[model samples]
Target: MAFPKELYNAKFVEYIESLKILYLVDDKFKVICDDYCSSKMKTEKYKKKFEKYFQHKLEFENLSKELEDEILIYLIRKG
Candidate 1:
């Protein structure tokens, strides 16, 4: 579940997030992101939401796969 640190950009992030893909497993499965339901910028809404929800930048934050795919990735591929 680890990739090059530099590849973790808004687009890639959004791409993976939208895939509804889950990463890591300790007890069953954990979502990596949020529902990224916004159209503008895609990641901006989540960035702000996470910042407000968790009080931090979305970049440094690790969300559930649901939120990650929903909020980060696009609809074409699964990152």
Candidate 2:
């Protein structure tokens, strides 16, 4: 699957080259990105069952936001 590095904002795709370099050299950053993508996927999955999975969707959305913040911080600092 393609990386979901560009899912958050335009800056991610704009800095694609820098992101590629960081992904190759930073283990923690890679983990954060992967977790962000996973949380996003889970959120989408739960979204289909809005009533039944409301809590699950909300949890994943929060997790996704946190992970996205970490990713942005790393990109700003090291990308």
Candidate 3:
């Protein structure tokens, strides 16, 4: 499958190839990617709406970061 636009994030750029591979073969990784994309989209929407001080936005941002870290760790470990 084609990479989803929602999964395009600067932080994940370096891991694009690995992500694509894992996305196709690993169910858990796919879910993580989906959740990461969702959190990123929500974070952007909240940022636009609240401009930086919204609690929900912060929460989403934090979740996005945590998910990102998880992805990085998983990729590194898989290597």
Candidate 4:
């Protein structure tokens, strides 16, 4: 399911406005904001960039979870 277009647009605009304020406050934020703005050039391309970032992050978490399970099992056996 997808969010309603109106809600999505409103939220996006709100985020952009907040980012603009952040950009004004710090010079460093301007560079990241500029990169984010440029990434919006093409729909699928931008989507892929976001997807790739989250996929890598989730993969790391999954690996951590596996290790945690292993440690718990070992501790239980030793107890």
Best by lDDT: 3
1 against 4, candidate with superior TM-score: 4
Better of 2 and 4 by TM-score: 2
**Worst lDDT window (10 residues) for model 3?**
1-10
Q: How many clashes show up in model 4?
A: 0
Per-residue lDDT of candidate 2, residues 1-79 (tens digit): 3556435557577877777667678889888778877887888777777866887888999999999999999999997
| Reference-based TM-score of each model | 0.20, 0.49, 0.54, 0.41
Q: Name the candidate, 1 or 3, with the larger lDDT value.
A: 3
Q: Point out where model 1 deviates above 4 Å.
A: 1-40, 56-79
Model 2: residues with Cα > 4 Å off, grouped in runs: 1-11, 51-79
Clashing pairs in 4: none
- Model 3 regions more than 4 Å off: 52-79
> Where in model 4 is the C-alpha error above 4 Å?
1-45
Who is ahead in TM-score, 1 or 3?
A: 3
Query: Each model's RMSD to truth, in Å?
Result: 25.0, 22.6, 22.0, 12.2
What tens digits encode model 1's per-residue C-alpha lDDT throughout 1-79? 5522433457766666533344333323332222233233467767787768665445346555567777656654554
